[model samples]
Target: MLETIYTENAPKPIGPYAQAIKVGEFVYPAGQIGADPATGQLVEGSIKEQAKQALLNLSAVLEEAGSSLDQVVKTTCYLSTMENFQEFNEAFGEQFAGHEPARTCFAVQELPLKALCEIEVVAVVKK
Candidate 1:
């Protein structure tokens, strides 16, 4: 069976999708943007700032699913442009820190709410 994850600390889904879903031993969080959960509006700032907020949002969803950054086994990141790659990487690195998870990043044409970046992760739920 699968369990849907939700948390007020993260932005509500802008579409018909759950924040994350848990199955068996893992949780898969949907891609997160820089939108503030309280306002449902994209945070105003540079890619670094936006990326940080995205990670923070991802964290909230993961925590709600009984997982965390430390337990993250893999990640997929999307950026609107490659121009901000360096700053985005720095922000992502800051969050992952010593426990870096396998990641795949790509530059996309556009994003929801005009967000500069979006992040998602797969993590092992705590037993």
Candidate 2:
């Protein structure tokens, strides 16, 4: 059975989708922007700040789904500008730390809320 994941610690989905969905041992987290859950506002700052918030948002979703960044097997990242790639990588790298997941990143024309970056993840949860 598939289960939807939700948490107050993460920003609510702005669209008609769950924050994450668990099926068997895997959890698929939706793409997260840099919106703060408490304020429901896009975090305002540099690309680094935005990337941090985005990772925090992803963390909350993974936690809610009974997984974590360490359990994450793969990730897809979207950036509004490739020029921010190094900055975004710096922030993202810190979050993942020693557990590096398979990842693909690309520059997009834009993201929801006009944010600098967004990330989606897939993780393995303890059964």
Candidate 3:
């Protein structure tokens, strides 16, 4: 069976979708941006700060789904510009630490809330 996951600790979806979903031993978290859970406002700052918040938001969603970044087997990241790739990856690496999950990143034309980056993960969880 599949289960939906959410938490007030993470930013609520601005659109019609759950923050994450769980099935069997896996959790798929929807892409997260730099919005704050308490205010629903995009965190204001550089790509580094926005990327940091996005990762934190993703972390909260995964936590609610009984998983963590360490368990993520794969991830997809979207960035607003290729120029900020290195800056985003530096912050991303700090968040993931040594647990580097297979990842794909792309420079997109735009993103929700005009966020600098958005990140989503596929993780293994103990169901």
lDDT of 1 by residue, 65-116 (tens): 8888899999999999999999999999998888889999999999999999
The reply for model 1, stretches above 4 Å from the true place, is: none
State, as a TM-score between 0 and 1, how close model 3 is to the true structure: 0.97
The lDDT for every candidate, in the order shown, is 0.92, 0.91, 0.91
lDDT of 3 by residue, 3-35 (tens): 999999999999999999899899999899999
What TM-score would each prediction reach against the true structure? Answer: 0.97, 0.97, 0.97
What is the alpha-carbon RMSD of candidate 1 to the true structure?
A: 0.8
Task: State the TM-score for model 2.
Answer: 0.97
In candidate 3, position 68 carries an lDDT of 90
Candidate 2 deviation (Cα RMSD): 0.9
Model 2 segments more than 4 A misplaced: none
